[model samples]
Target: MLANLLLEIGGSMSTLGAGIGAGLAVIGAGVGISGVGGRAMEAMARQPEIFGKLQTAMIIAAALVEGAALFAIVVCLLIAGNA
Candidate 1:
C-alpha cells in the first residue's frame, strides 16, 4: 500500500514539473521574441535604408525561438503523458 501511494505521488509530481517547465518555456519565448522585435525596430529607426534586412533577420530569429519553445512544450507534454 505504501509503495503504491509513493508511486502515485511521484507521478503527480512529474506532471506538475512538466506543467511548470512548459509555462517557463512559453514565457522565455515571449521574452526572446519581444527583445528581438524591439531591437530590430530600433535598428530600423537608426537606418531606414536597411529596414528590409532587419525585418528579415528579426523574423528568422523569432521563428527559431518559437521552434525551440514548441519543442520544449512537446517534450513536457510527452513527459506528462508518460507519467
Candidate 2:
C-alpha cells in the first residue's frame, strides 16, 4: 500500500507540474502581449502618423512571444503524455 501511494504521487507530480508550467507559460505570454498592445495603442493615439510602424513592430513582437509560449505548451504536453 505504501509503495502504491508513492508511485501515484510521483506520477501525478510530473503531469501536474507540467500542466502548471504550461499554464504559467501561456499566461506570461498573454500578459506580455497585452502590455505591448496597450502601449502600441497609446503610441498610435499620441502620434497618428506613426501608427503603421508602431503597429507592425507590436505585432512582430507579440508573435514572437506567442510562438515561444506555443513551443512551451507542446513540450509540456509531451512531458505529460510520457509521464
Candidate 3:
C-alpha cells in the first residue's frame, strides 16, 4: 500500500543505524588509542630519558579520547533502545 510505503511501521532502520554508529565509535576509539600508544613509544624511543612524562601524557590523552567514545557509544545504545 502507498500508506505503508510512506509510513514505515515496526521499522528497524533506526536500530540498525544506531548499532552501526556505536560500532564505529568503538572502532574509532581503538584506533585512537593504538595511535597514541604507538606514537608515545616512538617518541620515547627517540628520547629514552623522557619516557615517564611521555607515558603519563599519553595515558591521559588516551583516557580522554576513550571516555568520549564511551559516551558516544552509550548515547547510540540509548537511541537504539528507543528505536
Candidate 4:
C-alpha cells in the first residue's frame, strides 16, 4: 500500500526512506514546538511573574527543534538527489 506508493514515486529504497525520514523529522519538530508552546502557556498562566522567562525558553526550544528539522530535511534531500 503505502510502501508501493513510495516505491513508485521514489524509484529506490534509499529515496523512499529519505522521504519518510524527512516527513517524520518535520512532524516531530511540529510536535516538539507545539509541546513547548503549550507548556509555556500553562506555566505562564500559573506564574504570571515569570512570563518573560518562559517565553524566552520557549523560543529557544522552538528554534532548536526547527534547526534540527531543517538539518534532517537537508540530509534527506541530499540522499534523494544522490539516489
Candidate 5:
C-alpha cells in the first residue's frame, strides 16, 4: 500500500513540475515581449518619423519570441501527458 501511494505521489509531483515549467516559459516570453515593446516605444519617442518601421519590426520580433515559447509549451504538455 505504501509503495503504491508513493508511486502515485511521485507521478503527481512530476505532472506538477511540468505545469510549472510551462508556466515559467510563458512568463519568460511575456517578459521578452515586454522588453521589445519598451524598446520600440523608446525608439519611436526618439525618432517619431520612424514610428511605422519600428512598430513593424518590434511586432515581428515579438511574434517570433511568442512562437518559440509556444513550442516550449507544447513540449511541456507532452511531458505532462506522458507522466
Candidate 6:
C-alpha cells in the first residue's frame, strides 16, 4: 500500500514538473522573440537603411527560439506520458 501511494505521488510530481517545464519553455520563447523584435525595431529606427537585414535577422532568431520551445514542450509531454 505504501509503495503504491509513493508511486502515485511520484507520477503526479513528474506530471506537475513537466507542465511547469513546458510553461517555462513557452514563456522563455516569448521573451526571446519579443527581445529580438524590439531590438530589430530599435536598430531599424536608428539605421533605416539596414531595415531589410534587421528584419531578416529578427525573423530567423524568432524562428530558432520557437523551434527550441517546441522541442522543449515535446520533451516535457513525453516525460509526462511516460510518467
TM-score of each: 0.97, 0.89, 0.86, 0.83, 0.90, 0.97
- Among these predictions, the greatest lDDT belongs to 1
Q: What is the C-alpha RMSD of each candidate to the true structure, in Å?
A: 0.5, 1.3, 2.2, 5.5, 1.2, 0.6
Model 3 earns a TM-score of 0.86
lDDT of 5 by residue, 16-83 (tens): 99899899999999999999999888888899999888888998999999999999999889988988
Q: Candidate 4 residues 20-55, lDDT tens each?
A: 999999999999999999999889889999988788
Give the higher-TM-score candidate: 2 or 3: 2
List the candidate 6 regions with Cα displacement exceeding 4 Å: none
lDDT for each candidate structure? 0.97, 0.93, 0.89, 0.92, 0.93, 0.95
TM-score of 1: 0.97
lDDT of 1 by residue, 3-83 (tens): 999999999999999999999999999999999999998888899999988888999999999999999999999999999
**Residues 1-83, candidate 3, lDDT per residue (tens digit)?**
97876445444777788889999999999999999999998998899999889989999999998999999999998988886
> What does candidate 5 score on TM?
0.90
Number of the top TM-score candidate: 1
Residue pairs with colliding backbones in model 6 are none
Model 4 segments more than 4 A misplaced: 1-11
Winner of 3 and 5 under lDDT: 5
Q: Between candidates 2 and 6, which one is better according to lDDT?
A: 6
Write out the backbone clash pairs for model 4: none
On the 0 to 100 scale, the lDDT of residue 31 in model 2 is 97
